[model samples]
Target: MSVSDTIVRWRYRAVPDHLLGEILTKNWIDNAIPLLFLAAVVVAFGSVIPDFYSASNVAILLRQWGEFSLLVLGLTIVMVAGGIDLSVGSTFALGNIVALALLNVAGWPLPAVIVATLAAGAAVGLVNGLLVGYLRLRAFLTTLVTLIIVRAVVDMLLLKYSVKIAGAFVDSDAWYFLGEGSILGIPFSVVVAIVVAVTLHLVLSRTRLGWHVLAVGGSRRSAHNVGIPVRRVICATYVVSGTLAALAGLLFASRLGGAGADTGLGLEIAALTAAVVGGNSLGGGRGSAAKAIIGSVTVLLMVNSLVRLGVPSGANSLLLGLVLLAAVAIDVRWLKNRHKVLSKVYVSPTYAALPAAPPTDGDSPYAVNDRLRSVELIGLGDIDGPEDVILDADDNLYAGNRTGDIVRFLAPDYTEHEVYAHVGGRPLGMAIARDGSLLCCIGGMGLYRVAQDRSIEKLTDETNRSWFSVVDDSRLKLADDLDITADGRIFFSEATVRYEMHEWPVDCLESRGNGRIICFDPAAGTTRTVLRNLVFPNGICMAHDGQSFMFAETWACRVSRYYYDGPKKGTVEPVIPDLPGYPDNINRASDGTYWLAIVGMRTPSLDLALGMPGFRKRMARRIAPDEWLYANINTGCIVRFDESGRIIETLWDLGGENHPMITSMREHKGYLYIGGITNNRIGRLKLNDADPSWTGPKSYWGRT
Candidate 1:
């Protein structure tokens, strides 16, 4: 075997058939594991340790977890924004000392002391933010220095004062209640912590600031390019962290009735551990406030249990260190293998082995022809991936390019091209509307319309999600092709709702129903699903009767017909039962037939692999993309079909020298225009018998 063959064999293997449930719930498991472990620890310790779950001990647990919870919440925000603040522990210590000094030494009012303490924390955080965000300093180093400096200064102040506040009664009752008082059998501190956690959870999950933070963390460069306030978002996260840490310190000092130098000594590490153990990614953009709470509870439970079991203080530290290391390692591995785990759960459809290619003799229907051999290449080096091409009444050729642009080649020599519009996504099948607007289906984005002034407008990017989908499926995942009806209704196909546009091949590997057909009615201003649970629905074209439309399910290797008007309205039937290759865009031909572009041919190896879902799953998880058994798209052919689903003729580019992977084909004025997703140029094939003056818009709407 060749080196490539050996590599392919090693990558392909069988996966367990019964692991679908595990794959679907992997994310929930990641979040719930820490909570479950904490529960187990509680049960184990409570059974042996005396009064471990007693009322008094439970209250103590709540108070301790509450204090740590505050710090963890702050750390979560900073971490989610892709930054780290090592000075939170120091800030907590400093805030406590400042509060005590203001209340006891300066003789300030309790409220003023509390505000000033929190302000001090915010100020420290501002400095860290300025250094990291504005000055572009490394977050770790900058916060580390701040931690040392703040800790030393706070410790010096505490040593110098060595004073305690002496008031127990009416004067400080309100202040005392904040930290030590109880409400409805729960500690006041615990109540406060719950409130803060709930509020921050809502803020992080529902607000624009939360999105900005996640975006910046996911990719700073991308966030900047999209005009997000990356630096400001990062800076604000640090400020929130400092403020919360200070509040935690105030609660600690109030509950203990005194401030100590080592009050928050190891709090930074503890908070970090809680965040990570709760499934928050340290690398950023993938954590939540709720996770922080669960993590904090888990960490506190372990420490409390150890202390109750007579474990030495040093041993407690060692245990925590080990736990932190384990948690980080688990988090990193989970993040790295998440996609693989998901792939394991996908169940692919079984496909029969593809028969040998039909004889290419001159008398055979599948005879090889050189129709595309002498094709002229347009936009040779300028355009990339013109997946679909169309023409207007003036015979101006238009094609969607890979760079999110729709380029138009003016008539008369058809050489000069100009960028018609930038759709901000890969534009696919296009249709000319009655009002002269261009309707385009963008890959990642949804169906859009390009106006006469070259302005792009989103018609609709969402449809009714399937009832079984737990995910928010309102947004279109991959809008592949679209066709406009005479009555202003638009029919489109979402290739696969499960995967993004770039992961199109992954959808084929799964071979499960992840696609659907949708109809957008401009008159009603609504978009609704016409058919559901389709397997890779692709090209769409209106029928000659204008009462129905034909759409292709690429992975299923068939074209289906759906009638919107007439006797078969609200029903769908197969147009073409099978094809030799994966069909892409289907356009109406001048002779009232349809032209279907086969993007890829079926290979024996790929056909056999499809029959074994286990092998496909294993390949998805283990093999690199370049080595995967992708559909054979290097060779292609365009076939014409009549209304009865009978093949009229086949045009092949056997060598693919000029036109490879034909995704779309449009017949205009005696010429067939072809486009491909990976090709760098547009192809033109002249036809001797077709009308020389007919254009797409003229055929559909007649001359204005």
Candidate 2:
């Protein structure tokens, strides 16, 4: 190899640059900036103030964090449900006054005081929920009104009972413990805060209510269309916010043992800043409990650090306003542009240099001929994009189309056809199981079965994830083909994990080893990857010996055999090391040979680009997707080969008028049935010297 070729190969193929792009595409990446900022602030504060990390000061900080975190968590839930609660601060103050009045002026029991304080907060929340959710009032204006009303109520109560509350004192040990006691070296309030945080996290992540909140926040019209109780979810979120804010106020009253006009003042603004800075979206539907806690801690630390630095109160407010402004700007821009950035970097091209294609021009074994030119067309114009064809025991032909329907034609005459099943995903390769059920590979979905009753069931959509992979490889992204073994194990191929079905062209451009072979055992109910890092593994056919199967790597233009059972198990060996065109689905022939479909032919221009990864990468980045160079899939032909990998003959539609770009072919009842991914019909060519009684099902399962 030349020096340039070696360097290109090592840089593009060996180095895992694509993983960086994959990491950027993950949702967790949104929290990275906030976490980093939090770390930087803590370091800065600790350096400036020696006492910031002292044990006594740290305990004081934790006590403050406990109450502040609850307020932020409540707001986070409300925002996630596509609403806001500006009344949280006012409700907190109201709860404090109500708790003090019940304890000192009314002389109620401690439990009654707690209950009354909570009810006051809930009542405020109910008004907001009813106005915004049921009456269709704007959330911002409704909550603002409630904030004013609740604050006014708190001021009135404080004016009426300020003297009596200051003099009265509770002497009970339980009351003192609730206020300033420690549990296991942690503050009593902090322990309660941690428990509440964990419970809310579970509810948000693992419950149906959380899913409903996200759905409603994402799109209320869509949520309602899907039968979600949108208004009720919104109302419930406000109620949750109110209850949590009240709880925080109760904790504060316990710790402080007093109330004033400025109690809970500007608390709402601080909570909003913390939630937004922590990485929770103000636009809603995309946040978590962790985000709320992180934001709260970061903001709380900064505020305390400013006070310790002796910064003027007005200047502190100015600095906080600036920080909130910066956080909001970053959040809005990141939310708007993340997907755009992902699209630009996600399609990472890599080096791919296939061996020189076999000779097909002259008297070589792979020489093309027009043997398929005069083949009869079946269901012509009545079907579209029949990627693969199969037949049942009665010789009834079934073909999957681009519209996600499996169409079936009656036997013998081949005139009448009907939609066999509506699978709802583009179905590719198919096989008839011994139990008379039809197993199919759906493009975006995984392996599925169409039973004798025509009911559809998913076999498996995931496998064990690869340990070294940056992207999650467990979910089946593009299941391509399959063939069953003698022991009821189904061996299949996944064309590419990084791209979806419509993105196959992008996979072709990359030409990387993004494919794998998988095995699904019926008895054990397990699916696993048996082979990894193959180049667009497409076609799968159980070898005649039953111990192995032949799979085609499309981009590499070759076929290989994988031993799944017996002595040679877990081994892979090349069957057809080179081909003139891109190989797709492979099927057993009636004469014990195999039929391979050349989905696309190779060209010198494309071959040159594969060796130059730099050129493809530039093209992908600079050129519009529709204008970029694409593989020539408009013209394809079928090749017949024996078990020894010797090409016996090649067939083509030289006129390109029928069966253009063949993707699959099946032999049944003396005829070879052809299907194409881009063609509008099925082609049937009479095999001159084939077994007339042979059918695919009969060959695999034997006579019933």
Q: Count the backbone clashes (under 3 Å) in each candidate.
A: 0, 0
Write down the lDDT that model 2 would get. 0.89
| Inter-residue clash pairs, candidate 1 | none
lDDT (C-alpha) at residue 451 in model 2: 99
Tell me the whole-model lDDT of each prediction, alpha carbons only: 0.83, 0.89
Off by over 4 Å in 2: none
Task: Residues 438-499, candidate 1: write the lDDT tens digits.
Answer: 99998888999999888889999998766756566779989989898888899999998778
What is the overall TM-score of model 2 with all chains considered together? 0.97
The worst-scoring run of ten residues by lDDT in candidate 1 lies at 347-356
Cα RMSD to the true fold for all candidates? 5.5, 1.7
